[model samples]
Target: MGSVWMYAPEIGYGARQSLVGFTVEAADGVIGHVDRQQDQPGMQHLVVDTGVWKFGRSVLIPAGAVTGIDTEAQKVRVAPSREEIKAAPRFATDSETADPGYLSGVGDYYLSLRS
Candidate 1:
């Protein structure tokens, strides 16, 4: 399996392109928009701001979960469903996001969904 932090090669995402403000869609439907993204090698991920969807909560989605990126439409699609994303480990603070342990837990959760 490929690293969860790296976007799948098939996604064909340009490394220099900014995904911020792009709408994010889950398998079911629209979930939110990309508020921020970490493009650093081995740490790639998107921080989605789910406005009014989950009471303004934010979720951290690893790049590997991204199934597609439509630059023309400014949209990103992930493999998970809305419920699956909502059930993911809560993204609380930047401090936690920086913690190796916390990130591992989050990564493990997403990886498990593949099975």
Candidate 2:
């Protein structure tokens, strides 16, 4: 498998396009909207603001989990189910977004879903 931080080749996410505000959908249903994105080559990810769903909490979704991108509909589709995404390692925005160890743990959690 490729690095979880990089988008799958088939995801077709344009480098210049912004995903902020786009709806994020898990395999089973809508989860949230993209609050922001980290597109630093090897560390791409999306910070999704799950309003009301998780009590306004935000979650970090690695790019590799993205199954598709629909610009017209302003949506992003991910491979994991809602439950699986909810169970991912908690994202500590203040301290963990740029922490290598935290990113690795998050990557491992997503990678395990493929198996």
Candidate 3:
């Protein structure tokens, strides 16, 4: 269990906002819809319900992975592919969401992709 470096905001960023019900689009295609979002700087994340795509499993998407959010279209664009997101650390409950160790794993996973 270890803590990874916090996300560094690139190209600046808007105020932390909710993305619930917003459709998440991967580079290839739509992945799922946002069930919840944590907009805290450095600890931001999205709780996405994969619907029928992954048998309704929910995954945690780090906020840094988000490229853009289109309020008009109600869509959130993510940089990671569907497969990457599918393989990300799962978010089964609120407790897991708050767990530093779990979050560290997620952070490590995403960070590994950039390396």
Candidate 4:
């Protein structure tokens, strides 16, 4: 098998933090909520909510997508800009992520976008 990233949830997030929530930057600073997390040690998946990410149609975020992990806040900040991630393949909240074929296409498009 290949390598994978890590996530820390034992610390938990902010009290007001809501899963499927969006991280908003205000005068105070950047704050957000958690929508859902895969959590399984070997598996990698994150379901960001559409409510926070208004632009996207879906919420499946690859584990490696994270740029930094706020162990203190128990939050994950993705490396790609919000717009870049939003432009990635977005799925409906009700529907599960598409098949590998779909992921492959998304990966290809995202790779091309980075180039």
Candidate 5:
């Protein structure tokens, strides 16, 4: 019970560890479903599963480790992504949590890129 509360509604990624088919919803609408993960040097991009409207080529999401997911709202909100989702810290598939030391340096670089 205690551990469950840690990565849930409150904050941070839940105990669950997997982003294969995790949905990625944006403003206008459910942008697209996560097709694949790319862990680069500064940010992690998600390849969306779009039929024909191939707009987003791996939309950049924060590396805060994908905190909580609102199943009802159908939204995948990350901590660092709020401000600079496109430039949020990058995280590898093994990343369990966001690092504080590297956050400030990012300086919300991707804030303007938000849709």
Candidate 6:
């Protein structure tokens, strides 16, 4: 299997190991702030708390979806549109992060959108 390369910095390239508490923006607008991030090489992801935007629901966004990270602004940019994210499989529980089946579903869903 191939590793899913996470966000690619538009200006240059380097490893950005953390993103907790960074606000996330979709193609159209800000979606939420990242509450947590996974550093796994193949399965990087961000756990975003939607706050009042989605009635406090949390979404797990694949790192591949991230476009850039602005450390100064404390923000992360993602490619998926707001609607696409809202339609993605929900990340409701902490344990779900370790479930291969659930992760596969999320990966498949985003992959489908790319095609």
Identify the candidate with maximal TM-score: 1
Per-model TM values vs. the true structure:
0.96, 0.95, 0.85, 0.56, 0.40, 0.88
Would you list the rank order by TM-score, best first? 1, 2, 6, 3, 4, 5
Model 5, clash count? 0
Which ten residues in a row are the worst by lDDT in model 5? 1-10
Global lDDT of each candidate: 0.93, 0.89, 0.78, 0.49, 0.43, 0.81
Q: What is the TM-score (0 to 1) of candidate 5?
A: 0.40
Per-residue CA lDDT of candidate 6, range 14-71, in tens? Answer: 4464678989999899999999888766777889999998989999988778878888
lDDT of 4 by residue, 2-103 (tens): 122233344343333333444422122332344666554434556665453364344566554554555545556765565665576755652344355655
Compose the digit string of candidate 2's lDDT tens values, residues 1-115: 2579898887777778999999999878999999999998988999999899987889999999999999999999999999998999887574788677888899999999999
**Which candidate, 1 or 6, has the higher lDDT?**
1
Measured over all alpha carbons after superposition, the RMSD of each candidate to the real structure, in angstroms, is 1.3, 1.3, 2.7, 6.2, 8.6, 2.1
Cα lDDT tens digits for candidate 3, 1-115? 2212323356244555557899999999999999987766567777888999999899888877777888889898888899998888777897997788988898889878766
Better of 3 and 6 by lDDT: 6
Per-residue lDDT, model 2, residue 40, is 83
Residues 1-115 of candidate 5: C-alpha lDDT, one tens digit per residue: 1221123335443334445576665443454566665444344534445434444333434443345565555456544432233434443333422443443333344343323
Off by over 4 Å in 1: none
Task: Order candidates by lDDT, high to low.
Answer: 1, 2, 6, 3, 4, 5
Worst 10 residues of 4 by lDDT: 1-10
Candidate 4, superposed: residue stretches over 4 Å from native: 1-32, 39-43, 52-57, 93-95, 110-115
Quality of model 1 by C-alpha lDDT: 0.93
lDDT of 3: 0.78
